[model samples]
Target: MSREAAEYALRARADERDRISGDLLDLESHTTYQVLKGASLRGSTEQRWTATQESLTTLWQLNDAYRAVLRRAEQIRASRARPGAEQLAALTELLAGSSVILRAAAKPVERRSLIPQTDLRLTLDEAVTRMNAAFREVTSALNDIDAVWNRVLPRLDGADADLSKIHDLESELGETAGLTAEESELARLRTAAVEDPLGATVEPHLDRLTRLLASSRAELDLAITVKREFAARRENLVAALDLVRAAESEARLAHGAVVVKIALPPQAQPRSRVGALAGELDALDVSADPWVLRAKRLARLEDDARKAAEQARTTAKALYGLIGRRDELRGRLGACEAMAARKGLAEDPAVSESFARAHALLWNAPCDLTKAAAAVENYQRAIHGGK
Candidate 1:
């Protein structure tokens, strides 16, 4: 109401109007809002989107009405360099009065109605409050829809990729049965995601499908690899069997030599499963058998054959180790005798007796290693006069 107050109000309102205009433009051009505007939606999303559109329409209408009022006030203030009391009164009425008409009453088309439909109007402040409420509604709608889209779209894409992998794996194995159910489930989930994303429960179903797809892929991959590598695996098995036989032969020869040369050597470990493993390998007919079945059999056969080979090799090395120990003792006994001779103790009765006893144990068939080692220790001590 005063001239100065009206002038100040006009300036403040101008700034508010500009700010509201900019915000409105930003909201309209927002990416999520634009996406919702053009999307074909269903379920709760469609319902919320419809309500949000009405709120957005009301928000723009309110902004336009608010701007019209501010423009009117600005026009009145600009009419005079220094407005009179009449101009100030008009500015006050436009700025603070119920000047924004939201809706006009419809006139009677056929007959006059007894009750009058009232016009919805608000003051400048009330218009802004209503616009803010509508803005919140619209923005909330955008957020909800954006959240659903963000959560479900990426999951759908991942499921689709898994489906593609299943298809590829199946193609490699030439096995395509039992996959239709998974494909149908994916299609159902995709439909729910695109249409009723607000209520779509996709993650649990997608997780189950993903696990199934992964298992199927693993099985198919194994079958494909087994089929392609069957010949190589068979060759590896044969090589392993040959190694087993060679190692077994070497162990037998060493066993015979030890039996003749040592008094009581430990018996060689018996050969294991060579015939049985070879029979199993021969029974695997890759041409007529399912690769899955053949793969299981081949894997068992390879394991058995390799273990047999390793055992035979270990046996041979042990038998050879016994012979090496005997030779080493003999060499040590000779060295002790040479040392006795160097000291002029070879003819010493006690020294000579220790040397002969140790020599007999080191040289005789079926040598008693425990006594031989004791005799050598006695000879070593006799050279030093039992020190």
Candidate 2:
């Protein structure tokens, strides 16, 4: 190379070396790299991190050698106001020749022989290439481990906090019956996350534990409320039972009226569980039973009582509907008779007979609604001038 070309090359390489040195400082001081360096990793993270450390060591050694070459070139240039041919030649060799020596003495036991080991040497450009590859390897490993810790560790902390809340609720309620499995699961997840986060599956387990904790809190709250307010709740349930009894009595009276006034009425709905529910409520040994058990029992009893009252009210409405139909037929029959009188068919034998049968069927006790409906139609036809 010519003198002028060597001078330009030396200046470019020196600048590149400075940039690489700044990048190395940034990598060493990175937060994730620091965390991985101090962490005791296992599994995939351990294997990858071990390889990355080897690459990082080699990268630093390469940088040192690169700096040495630039330093030699700078010294040669600074030696004279205008370097001669020999100085330029030496500068070209340092900037562009095989000037960086890479130590390769470490070898496997099987690869060792009696021959002396030789160091591998490369030019400044080749040294930078090798260092770039090593830097990439180290950065990729740090990022991978950082991603796993970022994704799993925060979730583990959140799960631990939830478990603490559940324990507090259990203490407040003075119960310790159902959380053993959850506690064991939480411990296992935390251990795996800390020791082998690279391979741990934490989200699904955390979600399930969250749901279980919510259910446990709800149950604990229910038990506490039942313990504190059982008296007021029992009173409300008793009043519901009284309403059921009232509906049952009203249904029975309507059924009797329908039986006397209408023919072929449907049978009355059977008495519901009001008596059984009242007995169950009275038999509840609140002082003896656990609040959880009492809560379940009270819930069942209240539901049953509410259903019984609704059924009785429905039955009463249906029975009264049958009596209302009979009254409706009577009114229609009377209106047909008045229309017959207006048309001068009141004296007609066939019209009078039809009106009589319809009136008797409608006004008489145990009224046959089907026959009364047919008779009313006949009377109406007669009033419309049908023979």
Candidate 3:
């Protein structure tokens, strides 16, 4: 190659350098381009950021290579003009080089190799290629940034909405009168969530918020069931109270109707214990404070009321049994006397004595049921062979 080709090649490199330098300067100056310079990125973002940084560094070096090769060309041209043995040796060395190696880190090495050649056409091509590659990589990084932003933006934006929904759920529980006295930290976190919705620390709580809402819903459902059951129990107590009164009234009526069958007034009546149970039931204040249905107190009260009703019914049965037995004894004693007359036992002294004793026991005041039963059996055996 002649001096003219070397100078022309140098001029061409210089022109291309200006164009690439201007483009790079514009890229560096742009606000959006510079935004992520010092900021740290995480996960896959970090890898992309590192790749982009490396590409930009390489492009900058390639752009600065134009100056380096031009300086070296000038030196080779100067040494070729003089044609000394040593100068020609240096010129030959420059002509032997085919590439312009641009190393940004080694300033001393670059200074020593200032005498570059016109043989760097390959270097120019490679630099342009690296610049295009770097530009494409930067565009890719920008796209990835947009994608990552899209991914997390909804979670960030909906943070407040989710928290508000949780509040609404809790309020619903409050409406049902089932809210527990225990407090949760969810309310306190709401303020922080509103302040920094995208904060890493608060972001994970979105899941917790969802779980809390679900848990509260379950608790509220259970509470509602308990509340309904308690209401049913209260109604049962009232019904039981009515049942008990009816049973008590039935006992008193039975006692009055069969007064002649049994001997006395008080002894034949249903026990006072059954009547006192009604008072105990009436004393239970269903309207009392802190009804505490969650603890099943209402169910306990209902059981007590039911038991009281059973007591009244049992007392009625006992009184009815006693009166019915007295009537049965009178009928049996009359039958025994008729049988004694028919069998010629009426004149028998033993038979007559048994019949008189049984008569006294069955017909008297506060009739001794145990003695009357034995006497009637004795009188029957003496009269008609225990018929």
Comparing candidate 2 with candidate 3, which one achieves the higher lDDT? 2
Q: Give the local distance difference test score of model 2.
A: 0.82
Worst 10 residues of 2 by lDDT: 264-273
lDDT of 1 by residue, 313-369 (tens): 787777778778888888988898899889999899999999988998888887777
The sequence of per-residue lDDT tens digits that candidate 2 reaches over residues 71-125 is 8889989999899989988987888799999877577899898887888799998
- Inter-residue clash pairs, candidate 2: none
Instruction: Compute each candidate's TM-score over C-alphas.
Output: 0.61, 0.69, 0.37
Model 3 stretches astray by more than 4 angstroms = 1-223, 229-236, 253-295, 384-387
* TM-score of candidate 3 against the unseen true structure: 0.37
What is the overall TM-score of model 2 with all chains considered together?
0.69
User: What is the lDDT of every predicted structure here?
Assistant: 0.81, 0.82, 0.62
Tell me the lDDT of model 1 at 204.
88
Question: Which regions of candidate 1 fall more than 4 Å away from where they truly are?
Answer: 104-116, 221-227, 237-387
Identify the candidate with maximal TM-score.
2
